[model samples]
Target chain A: MHSSESSEVEVKDVKNAGMPRRELLRYFFAPKAIAVIGASATPGKIGYQILYNLKRRFKGDLFPVNPKQEEILELKCYPSIVDIPEEVDLAVISIPAKFVPEQVRLCGEKGVKAVIVIASGFGETGEEGKKLEEEMLRYALYYNLRIIGPNCHGIYNPRTGVDTPFIPERRMAKPEPGNLVLVSQSGAFLGALGDWVSQERIGVSNLIGIGNKVDVDETDLIDWFKDEEETGIIALYLESVKRGKEFIRVCRETSKKKPIIIFKAGRTESGARAATSHTGSIAGVDAIYDAAFKQSGVIRAESLEHMFDVIRAFQRQPLPKGDRVAIVSNGGGFGVVCADAIELNGLKVARFTEETYEYLRNRFPPHYGITNPIDLTGDGDKDDFKDAMEAVLKDENVDAVILGIIWQGVVLEDEVVEVLAKVVKKYDKPVLGSSPGGEFSSMMSEKFNRLGIPHYPIPERAIKALSAMVSYVRRREEFFRDEE
Target chain B: MSRILTEYEASKLLSEYRIPMIGGSLVNSVEEVARTASAIGYPVVMKVMSPDILHKSDAGCVKVGISDEKEAERAYEELLENARRYKADAKIQGILIQKMAEKGTETIIGVVKDEQFGHVLMFGLGGIFVEVLRDVSFRVTPINRRDALEMINEVKASKILYGARGRSASDVNSIVETLLKLSELVEEHPEIVELDINPFVVYEEGKGGIGLDALIRIE
Candidate 1:
């Protein structure tokens, strides 16, 4: 099984001798002309919604292919891909599973570089579907054509306007273009995540849902995105890895340059059974996955929410030089909670240097706590937070800072948001914010997000995110040191 | 299905990779047991080597603290009798006699073939720490010195190896060397599906360690 699988990849390597894999992937993400096969005119259909989403942002030439329709979404429609006048770089197949292989063969004949198979039945259903997927793969490999999925939501690149997910904008909010690239094996997760990240204002460059993964998988994406100028972090939701050794090798190399966070599902026995049925993937031993991720410098998030929490930090803040964190909060109880969290997460609460101690001592009253996790008292205002933040961030011992800002405090003005934002940007150290409350606290959290600091709902989440960053930095350093 | 290699064969294979083991000799006769026991010095250990008996200690086929030739002969007879009672039709290979390893901090170094990741090396404190608490750390094999050190430090009970209380620090460097050697061994021999060096006796600093007992399973 292993030899045959590698031979297929080698055949593709021979076919595209000069062009690298990353360069070839551009045909999928940045195609100049895209033909949507099985384009529909009716509302609420998969074909129509795919074209609908693409028509909103895709600036390239769009051709809708259908046997019966003359036009779709006011765009000129073609009866077949071969009849299209212009050269097609990508084709999106949205027909049923039984017809997907023939369509893929037609795509190969038309010399389309890549095709996204957005149907659901192939490989995931049972033996018959698996046979259909095998036939589709044969057609793709014959012409050196790359396929994304036999059952997937397809790719979305906000910058290039090449959105292919079938979910319409009315149902799912599109995220703005930024540095994070998310890839998942489950398409529904990508649809729901689009809404979640948009609500939280987390900017993403690309969101790819690779189902069945007959051709493209997480390892290929990681290799491509490692050199992608727009991407600084690569996040994945994987049920199983197709090529475990190759995945580890690529991740180990890419993680030295960019942070890769993964949330591997199927940790328990029943969960593994569910994952196997859901994607037809064998979720091998979870403990081995843990070791491989650590050995490769990949941060494994504990949950789906934790995945984004770590991504938010990686997207906005710089990597801390060490695991020493300093906490500054107005609420004494919140500061104490953060101190415990920092230690529990394998991070040390930084000891402030004597100079920093004297600096805060001269600024605040004796009633205020002025050590690590410095409490500014309930009456502490914006100036007190400003002084505390600046003094700790500038100290050489502190690598990062977590601000436990309580919006419910009486004297703490809203202007403290702007004040703390300015202080955080001036230093190279990472600064995370946590504000736990209802409507007002969320509004303040958004303000902090806009200013380039990730704010969690509670202090524990912030500390956990910060701990992940520290671990990534430490592992990356060790990997490079071993090479030297 | 997998078959377990006799302890003598397993030790020979391990020694070929330069992994330290308490050297032993396999003898078929009772007089040969006494000769080999005296050659290796007193306070030796003797065990019945057989393909059918995987767990020698549990089968009562193992005897320790044989300080004299008379005791060695008696223990050898008892080991053979116990082996027959454990499995009447067991095809006994021979008896193994070696010098008893000096007690130190008990540690375990092992390897198991993962279906996806191939061979993975494991390290942990021995006995209750591994059985009850499952305090162990793992690394995919073909690991380096850095990975070996990390595996040792990752276990929660590693402090015992670092000289907790009044005990002297064990020679962790020796354990690291053993882990690295085992990694290479598995890489060279993929047929080895599972391995265990339980209670690998670790001595004081620079004094090295000994594989007190080992088991290897292969397809």
Candidate 2:
């Protein structure tokens, strides 16, 4: 929706300063060329990892600059940015604390436009680091340079193959750039999900491991990514927002334009404490953030993994037209849990029509519950599953269906994927999963994806995603319409 | 302390801060109104001054655009009768008649201090629709010229100030200047709790705005 570059724009002394900056962000999706200053040959360093990711992921031009090395990762390393041959659009700086100021200065002199500072010990550290960051920011501002972080991890644009490292977890890294852009304030929370999303074949568009954002914050990123054509869904894991008013405004404004899923870590005191310790982010006033979210219509994820779960579903399935959800479960308890999660998320579990009910009763047991949570008594086969799912899908009142497959016996992934895929594609309604059995969880999710059904790992995620989809429609109608 | 300061007390504090106020007398009766009317000018407006009464117009205590002694006496008697009828216990301190302030366009300017965020000044088209439309902008106060302009620009009625839909442009520059000056005054004197200048008649083209009605609550 919006571009990363646009978020770091200088609200110049000129009144029209912000508009041009917005235009600049559009180039971030597929950066034509990049300049890497402070490109170190050191093994564990962020620069090395960043270079590795970019060269491997991005198919665009890459320029490496290191005063100490002649070559880095087989790419020619220039002494300074002033020597880079190609006119670079973006610069990634991962150097020692002392040298960052000079590198920033040199970046401006070379006319390299945007810079991401993957260095620590800035304003977050104390007065000295704060002064250093302020000086660097002053230089960036004077040069019209857009800066991402002074103390932060980096950003990843999967579509562009532009990966800059400010994130910590090194060995467990798996680069998968799908259509979903997950912007997180906590690096560890985001860094953990990397392997899972890729292994599951879930598409991710952008992953920003932002830490102590000095120049560019979440507001900037939301503004940049909100309107991105490549990004189908946006998922965020934030403990605190630097600009409360702007965050609410952007989320309210963007949620209408596209589906934005959020995982806020600060609901309870303990969770908020963990979030702060993990990311140097305060849980903020939970009530205020909650109110802000409610006002703006952002879908709040229950946990970090749950955030990804809902996102995975949104990425796979087309949004259900309305809030009416139909639940199909093998067990009564699972059906009830699904119902609770649905209503808790502010959506109603839609009832099946009499025709659809008869369609189900003919195929399943007479004692089966069939109002909203169509429970096929504990002992039900694949035929019972298919019939119940079809009955729910056929109902005009049910916009979407949640399949709570227990998989009591041995479940074949290939077989289920084919059947579920057919039903999902035929009806054009989103179908989700809540298979309590451990043996079938992975297989259920796998099939869910193959058939274009957005399945959640938990009932909560399914409810959250459905609620977000409905909110996206509502927001678009309320704020993002043709008229102001 | 939420102190209710009289008009005189407010003018005294504002005088030190260079806030301009209209010259008038606080009259007790029809005789005093006649005397004040003669001294002030032929045409004068008498409004009831009471701490309990915030909305004088609604209370029928605001007698605007008055002319001569007989009219002034009748307006004062009518206002006093209405004020006593409404609140029953509200003391009619006196009638404040400065002059019939030259009416023009209407604009509102005020500041609200939030517990967590601090003082944020607001500027918009004044009156009943203010809360409804919320055509306003805010900035952490003790504002400079840039902030003042931004605050004024925060409202959609800003286009109306620029003379939208064939309406003549109001004195927007003056509106911003008054808000900035007002913000600085209130920020400096924390003793002044709430200050309002509703429908601050933005005078004729190029003539600058005037505070048509001024109310002050002090601490």
Best candidate, TM-score: 1
Q: List, residue by residue over B1-219, the lDDT tens digit for candidate 2.
A: 465555545555555655555647888867777888989997887888887777778888888778888999998889888989879999667888878777677776654433332334556676543656645555545555655765567567777777778878887778777777777786777565455555567755587776666666654
Off by over 4 Å in 1: A1-22, A270-284
DockQ score of the complex predicted as candidate 1: 0.32
lDDT of 2 by residue, A1-484 (tens): 1233334445444222344555545444566888777777876777887777787777878888877898889999898888878877788888777779888878777665677887788777789888888778776665656677765556676667777754434544555666788777766666666656766677677777777666677777787777777777777887677765566667767777677777777676442321101011111245445545654667777676667666766787777788889988767888889889888887888977788877766766678787778877666666667777777888899988888776665542336556766776778787777656565676766666656776656677777767767766765665544244
Candidate 1 lDDT tens digits, B89-193: 999999999888888988888887766677778888888888677788888878899999999999999998999998899999999999999999999999987
Candidate 1 local lDDT, A342-373, one digit each (tens): 99999999998999999888889999999887
Q: For model 1, name the residue pairs that clash.
A: none
Name the regions of candidate 2 deviating beyond 4 angstroms: A1-19, A26-29, A166-170, A265-284, A361-365, A369-371, A409-414, A440-446, A449-451, A456-461, A480-484, B1-219
- In order of appearance, the predictions have TM-scores of 0.93, 0.65
lDDT measured at residue B184 in model 1 versus the true structure, 0 to 100: 90
Residue-level lDDT for A23 in candidate 1:
57
